[model samples]
Target chain A: MDSKLTTTHPMVTADSQSVSSQEEIVLSVQHVKKKIGKKWIIKDVTFEVKAGEIFGFLGPNGAGKTTTIRMLVNLIRPTEGTINICGYDVTKQPEKALAYVGSIVENPEMYPYLTGWENLEHFARMQPGVDEKRIQEVTEIVRLDERIHDKVSKYSLGMRQRLGIAQALLGRPKLLILDEPTNGLDPKGIRDMRIFIRELASQGMAVFVSSHLLSEIQLLCDRVAIVGRGSVIAVGGVTELVEDTQHLVIWELEPQAQGEQILQSIPSIQVLDLESSNLDNDTAASLRPHSIITATPEEYISTTIATLVQAGIQIHNVRKLSPTLEQLFLGVTEGEFIE
Target chain B: MNSIWPLVQNETIKIIKKKRFYVVLLVLLVLVPMFTYAQMRQAQENRTKFGEDWRVELQQAITDNQNSLGSDRVPEEWKKYRRVFVQQMQYYLENDVNPNEPGGVTFTREFLDNSSSLFIPLLIMTIASDLVSAERTGGTIKMLLTRPIRRWKVLLSKLITLTMFVSLIVVSTFIISYVISGAAFGYSGFNIPVFTGFQPGDTGTDMSSVHAIAQWQFILMQMGLIWFVGLTVGLLAFMVSVLVRSTAASIVIMMAALIAGTILTNMAASWSTAKYLFMVNLGLTNYLSGSPAPIEGMTLPFSLGVLAVWALASVIVSFAVFTKRDVLN
Candidate 1:
């Protein structure tokens, strides 16, 4: 773990200026709560998205991620607490606060009847300091120059998403809030979006992306907050959240039923039952018998191996499993549906 | 507020690009010609029947209206209308200016005054009803409201755009009517005198209450007054657009209100409260032509005041509702 940390932490130090400027928080959502009629939709949600970082908001379905995003963009006001964007309270001074913030909530809902250029031109007029050059620059960044003249109704979903991103980038916003930016994209489109988002962060813009794709969040985000039931269950770096404190060791042995009985006799180790009922006859006949053994803090794997060997069990192989994001997410969310 | 100009420009561009304005122009192109042809045929029939004696025709109209006024079964509203018609015929007879002259300017002015009450309002509603509600339906409201500008500014820009298109529709109607009618009726009545400013009680030929204005001045003033009424209709439709989420609903509601107003004005004059309805007073051009009000006691100033209140109240309510309403998907 220390060796892995040494290799990865240097990437953080390479962008030393950005790392130092990370102290400049672009979005601060503190104790935010929203109640619609009789039910509380968001309960005391708090998080900070810093500059030059990709902040992932991971949550299960009905976790209030969109509600929180809507509140930040001033689409819906927070019932309690405050959301500050670039040091301005969203509720009190939305115009000034949201001046430097660009957002795409849910689907990139552009006017389908208008040409892509017309849609961008119309949105550009709404924001101050967005000139023709800025529009061209953003359109180029989104790689929409060739098709910008075409009506948006003719564009594919991927192209529409790109146009949406271009519109959001028009004002050179300090904080870009994209709710499910990669939704409905092919694998290549998703990859391109990932690269584009990283490039935007490299330009010192704080990006707050809310998504339920755990692997995409794991690969794309620098830090993430896992939300469940309208509350932040965990907030930490991606690697930190997935790092396991305890290791799971699997041992394959001859006559697994006898080995399980022998392992159950030891007080320091807990033996896991291998359910053979689910396996087909051909697979069950050809498969090696395996048992999962939990090693206590007081005992070593060698001790368990020695105990298994002394009980007349022939051990064929031993392996240890590293925790993955999928396992970590399941553990954090208790196997609830993320979508 | 300073950013409102670009917003207005953006809105105006959207409206123009949607091709809805061209629909108005196309409707005018088709319908105005048909109406002009019908009017030409009627004028030819009048000439064949009455032998082209302007004085005799004016005297006949005056006598007919006076005969209607003497009827015991005539309703009070029709009586008022007849009285105004008799007075107008008397004015035409005395001034020696033919009211039914087959000329471009005369036909255009009459067509404008006649259409101002219903046709212009319908056209304005077609554009105004979709201003805000269409944005909502198109999902563009999400893109619009997500910007840094205030919500009121967005609604104001729509209002401004609606006003621009309303003006365009009105001017286009006039130009189309004039050009089309000019083909049938020669364009040569620029200097003819028309009488205006006759009050409710005064006879139409009462020179003390009425004054003579050139044909061109009357057309300009009539256009200006009709523009006010068109703007009022647009504002009311804009209010409906803001209140409703569906463009179809907004257009239907405004159209129903307008059609109902005309029906009520014709048949429900006994309901005194109908005088205060916005549609009852939308015929601001009638005042310029010295035509009797749809309801009794609705003077030019009173109608103008009623329309002003309606416009002002619609704008206020629109701003209030739009600024606070949630942009729910």
Candidate 2:
């Protein structure tokens, strides 16, 4: 607990700075606050997403992540602040602003009664510069060309997701806002979406994605803003923010009583309490009872396992566990502060 | 994107794909045949009774109505309607032209006149109520409003599509009634001289302005007035669709209002203020056929003004609310 606090607290209080300031800023949300009814849902949020980057909007559910994304795409009006996209104000000049933006707020809801191709045509008509060729190109980009002629109701969930991305790319927007893009995807589908998002970013399009899962953002995003209780708690490079909480070693042993006692004698390592951990029960269930999770520096993991084994403990496995964004950014997602 | 035509095209395709207009066509297909069968049966009965003398038939109708006007049991409003019928039949008798000419064109004209108040406007509501609410229910509104076009432009395109379908519905009603009724009643009355331009008032109708025109011209004018009523009702339903979130609810609200209008039109004549309701003023065809208006102080100009005001208010409400309301989940 002492090491976790010392590692993540200073970064949480640090000013949110863009990691890659050299690229063109495609989206700038400045002090955005949204008030629904009498209570303020989003107290204050500010972030800039540059061109050629996957900027992850990281937050827990009800942390106002979706509400903030809505304000960005002009789906919901922000009571107090400005959202500009590619040099255009989203609220004042949504026509010019949204011209450079393509978004799927939740699920991509195309006209189910219309064929996939007809759905493309329906949206293509609303976007300037999107013609038959452009629609065909986007359909190919999402790899939905084979089923483009079928009714969307016949589409599988992954295919519907691909079609959603296909329509978003129809306008050739500079910035794409996807709210929980991988919320309902299979594992392979999620992998393909990450690759697809990276390919778009490499082509100089800015991708702003929001997700409640920190691990998803940790693997996918170049930079992230961690939101908690309707405000941004921290924004920095994903690597820089995750740098402090180094090695997470999973100590598996027989004779767990002797092994745990021997590991507690080491000064450099600290064991994480499974019951006290903020991770939901599913994550906890995956780790067996004989396995003990510990956070320690890289140099001590081998020695800690050696000491456990020398104490006549049978070493079944010495596996290294990577710290989740949940544990790495404890100042933001800590159990006491999250809700 | 600069032009609203693409949006209109999109809406047109949705309406077609959803088969909403097909529903309207099917309703007409089933109803018009039954109407023709009923008319054919009525015509057969009349022929057997009158022995081919429309003059004798007209004189007998006038005597019956005149006798009813003198009866104490006859309501004052019923007596007023009889008085107008008696006057109109007397005019036809003096002119030596049968008002009940049995032909395709005559049947279409008569059908349009009767359908204008309730039938045609109800058909208009089917498409108009589905205009905006379907998007909300189906969750496509999020995509629709996020486009580069202003919100009002999106709504305007829908309004244009609704208008096109409303006009299509009215024109199809005319054609279907004509074609089907023509197959049942022979199609040779287009050149018959028909009298129009009757100025109906509180006490009686003024026939000084009445003049003879071809049966086709009278049908054309009646269609023009009915189209106006259909368009007005379409605008109101469009407003309901904007205000209500579900298409079924929007349709129900409009159906209730239209049914209420029908009931109100049958009500006592003393409810003079009810004329302002757009539903009650939907009978614009009555002025053309020289029938009495439902209430006192109601005339062609008065009904037109009332309908115009209602349509204007609905348009204002639809645009104002649709452009401003939050598209909440």
Candidate 3:
């Protein structure tokens, strides 16, 4: 889906036009640093989230993702540097800077005793110009209208997440920040949240989602920044980050022992043994002993296949492996353990 | 700043919805009636033991105090107390008024005046002690502080809401006490005369300061005075709530201080400095009722000044800590 496409909904479109102008930056962090006691929690972090985009913040555990987010939301002050939201400095004028921002820091915790509608209404009262109609609209947008009257304690985790989003969406915020928005969601709930967040971005709201779930972030975010050890290691479009690098090409051939020896003779080809048995018995028997081979230039796949076939080994299948976000993350972080 | 009103309104709603307030109301609901019933039974026994003539009873009480004054075994403090009692008893006897009347308004006024020192403070602390800390535990403080409002404004709104609720609880206590006790003891005595300003001086009762006021007027003044003390207690608890992260700790600390204050007021006469403690001055109603100050040389103005300083310091510290501290979960 093209998340950049403008929706036909009048309210959303009007909001999009008024608040988001294509490339306008909604959130900017410049050389932000945070120190707690003697240790640096966030070290020289800097990034920007543009209008009409889902910007994913990916990091290993204890990598300062939450610390950066807290500074952006003004829950804690940065020891150094400035954060501007919609042109207002967060430290100097937090009330004005945060006026256009809505966020769920870690969990969408609310008053468990209060009903979902009451929670929305309570937060709505915190911001100006958020009336009953806007509350209803956001509630419907989250598909929580049917259960909005129930107490938050009774709502499932997925429902609580939706209600939290509804609360943030009140006042039609220009920037919606969700720290681990889908932390405790089921597969269907995660999918629903991904689509809903994209829909929010399409309506012109900039979303900053921080998560350890690389696959979800890969599918949901238009742009992503990976942070490791208190610093951002990579930032760009997901497709560009994954596709801009060299990858392996696996060539499956018949009579694997003969095919391996044939490919071994070629100086350009590198054959890696299968580390573990991943193939099912039926595919293994039907395919009749195929081995894996890699071409260094990747474009040499045709030559490697031709060379193998000429040596009397029948080529059964040829597959090119594209890098996934997980692979890219592991590669960039040097296989660092992610929590 | 323009959103302070809505913020205050929201806070008020949040407080009222908590089950703690209902628990407070329930305690009051059961407590006042039981107290009034005991008072009624005591009054009945008094009538049965000493005939129905309040004048005769007043004369006998004065004679007994006069007799005690002649005894050398009485402590100097009791001698001073007996001297004031004799003078006040004579005044009541001359005026043909019964000071201890078994009626709704009379019991309420007396109950509030007596309990202001401890019970009322305890109830107000229940609501105030959790004002900020409960939000932290429930994780709602993040939601509240992250809004497009200043932290001071948010804390100020909570303070204002606490002031409002303290007033509400005080008024409700009176109303609930009156209604429940009135059912048992007839709702009369609104116009009954109650005397004030019988100060205990170095020698005897300070007759020059004595005066008389109706029971309703006395109750109103008592309510106003107790409300001030309650607000002071609430403010102190508010500061503790901000400083401490747990609701139970805040309430316990405040309660411990108050309970210690009551004990100190009786025994800390020698300490002298104990009179300056904030909790010591919480009995503001004592001044209106013309009761002797708990400590020597501690007058109404002195107590008020001490309480004012405490309240001011609490406000400043609470705001300073809350606005600057990092809200880590």
CA lDDT of every candidate:
0.80, 0.85, 0.82
The residue pairs found clashing in candidate 3 are: none
Candidate that scores best on DockQ: 2
lDDT of 3 by residue, B1-329 (tens): 37589999888888877776897899898898889889988878778878887666677778988998999998766676678778887877777788876789888988998889899999999889999999998888888988888999999999999999889889999999999889888889899999988777776668786789999999998898888899999999999999999999998999999999998877676688888899889888887766667788888788888988999999999999999988777
**Displacement of the residue A230 alpha carbon in candidate 1, Å:** 3.0
Tell me the deviation in Å of residue A106 in model 1: 1.0
Q: List the residue pairs that clash in candidate 2.
A: none
Sort the candidates on lDDT, descending order: 2, 3, 1
Show the colliding residue pairs in model 1. none
Off by over 4 Å in 2: A1-22, A245-275, A287-329, A333-336
- Per-residue CA lDDT of model 3 for A279-303, tens digit only, reads 3233335442444735345677778
The C-alpha TM-scores of every prediction are 0.84, 0.91, 0.86
Candidate 2 on A1-339: residue-level lDDT in tens?
Answer: 011211122211112144343467788888889888899999888777788889888887888987887778777888997888877888999888899888998788989999999999999999898889999999999999999999999999899889988988989998999989998899999999999999999998989999988779988998888788888877777776676555567777888877887777788877778754454555567788778877678788777767776778899888766666566556444545633
Candidate 2 residues B1-329, lDDT tens each?
A: 58999999999999999999999999999999999999999988988999989898889999999998889999888888888889988999998999998999999989998899999999998889988999989889988988888999999999999889988998999889989999999888998998887777665878889999999988888888998999999999999999999999999999999999999999946889888898899999888888888888888999999999999999999999987776767
Residue-pair clashes per prediction, in order, are 0, 0, 0
TM-score-based ranking = 2, 3, 1
Report the lDDT of model 3 for residue B236.
96
Using lDDT, give the best candidate's number. 2
True contacts kept of each: 0.68, 0.74, 0.78
